[model samples]
Target: MKHLTYFIIFFSSINLFGQVNYSGFIDKYPIELSADINTSGNSYGVYVYTAYDDPIVLEGNLQKGKLIFFEKNSKGNKSASMTFEKFNLDSESIEGIWKDLKNGKELKITLSKKNEIGDGIIQKTSIGDRYFRIVADDQNVSEIKIFQKKTDKLIQKLKVDCQFRGVHCISTGDYNFDGITDFSIFESSYAGPNTSSLYFLYNPKTKKYFESGFSGTSLEFDAKRKRIIETNQCCAGSSVTTAEYKVIKNKMILEKERCFKWSEKKQELIERKVSECR
Candidate 1:
């Protein structure tokens, strides 16, 4: 598919996740915050200053009545931090301290609630042996939660690097052929049945899910053969490509590929070429 990339839309004001929207000042710099506090006391959100063009991702936890958030840069590194001594959702305004990790600079933060959306619950479904619920607005998925199927115990939570627009589909398979099921989310759609997804594989050693950087177009897992099939079609279905991959050390190793071109004479697709990947 098209190169995997995050599509960030600019908005002067955001109602992200339809959960918590705030307008605030960070030491005289105007800022807007859109966030959600999950039931497990974990928080994930984004904030942007009026003078900036991009938003900074914030991830943290609420513990002992304090909200501690770390500002994540584009590379997913914590560059700064914010700790609110007293944060109450019902409160109109709250205060906090912002600290830059690199320069050791500190600033006062004060935010006033601008709006509140009802409990953010975009979709809930179960796959394999886990229950998942996505917390997001109609535009984006901010957090994904995994719960034990039998006990309903929250096992893991993650923030994905993709957007959810319309119908969101989650797929699962034995990607590594390790018995445990791995899952993925549709990332985006492209021309003529071309799409990409973000894969999260189950790690039995850590008992957690890890995001896999596997890239392919419309990947389909063949559990019986333990292979991954990537299908791509373009040019009004006239050009097509299919690739087969084998999992080697938890990585996809391409083995075979085939190309097809539509033939007007035969009124069907004809095999154009075939090759093997080394």
Candidate 2:
């Protein structure tokens, strides 16, 4: 009897150390799962959420087929040890056993596979009830598609010409305060220090993203102040010109202008205000 008990305990210890293969699962499946860790105290808390549901707060570590952790409530005061069992991953779904520690309630949870856009990095934003997915392939954005989350209907498709290597070159926000999300792409000149930017403004009347006539180098949008700023360098960076514009009636109206030039006598930069908006 003593030898049999030792063998049972040894087998259980081997099963407890099994780990979930996160990288292999994400690569083979078209799903995204985000885990946020908060290490405010000695015990680290984790919040797990899929693209479909709200985050579930749990203070636990995974061991084999068990999630050994504490479940935290919304108030952050109450916690109980929650052990999830039967955690299994297959080709189409992730099956697990979810248990509520406080009340000793258990439920089976299965996460099904969902389709994603392109293989590139996906940047998502919402305008009202509609959501837009922007997929970028390295330096170039190959596709931009807008769809309704409820019905999965493709509303609009836009092909952009701007190409930049960095992810910061593309952004989406309500630049014009029109209650619609707009997109901007910044493209840098390959041979020069100059940059060119393009804007796609969302038109509610037409229900589409229309290309605005506004184009500039070194373009930036001040979302908090609702202003557009542009800067241009001339004479090989010897002189710099800056302009501020406000969007009015789908037009960028210049509001202020300033210029900076290198002073040969002072061996420094000098600033001057321009009276003309251009």
Highest-scoring model, TM-score? 1
> Where does candidate 2 have its weakest 10-residue lDDT segment?
1-10
How many clashes show up in model 2?
A: 1
Which lDDT tens digits does candidate 2 get at residues 1-278?
01111011111111122112221122233233322122221122222222332223444555555445566676885455534365343334555544566777665444553334352222323455555444554346666666654455778887775563322344677767676788766554522355676778987788788778887766778878889888776665556677899999988999987777666776555675554223
Model 2: pairs clashing at backbone N, Cα or C within 3 Å:
60-69
Each prediction's number of clashing residue pairs:
0, 1
- Report the CA-based lDDT of candidate 2 relative to the real structure: 0.52
My TM-score estimates for the predictions, one after another, are 0.53, 0.51
lDDT of each: 0.69, 0.52
The best candidate in terms of lDDT: 1
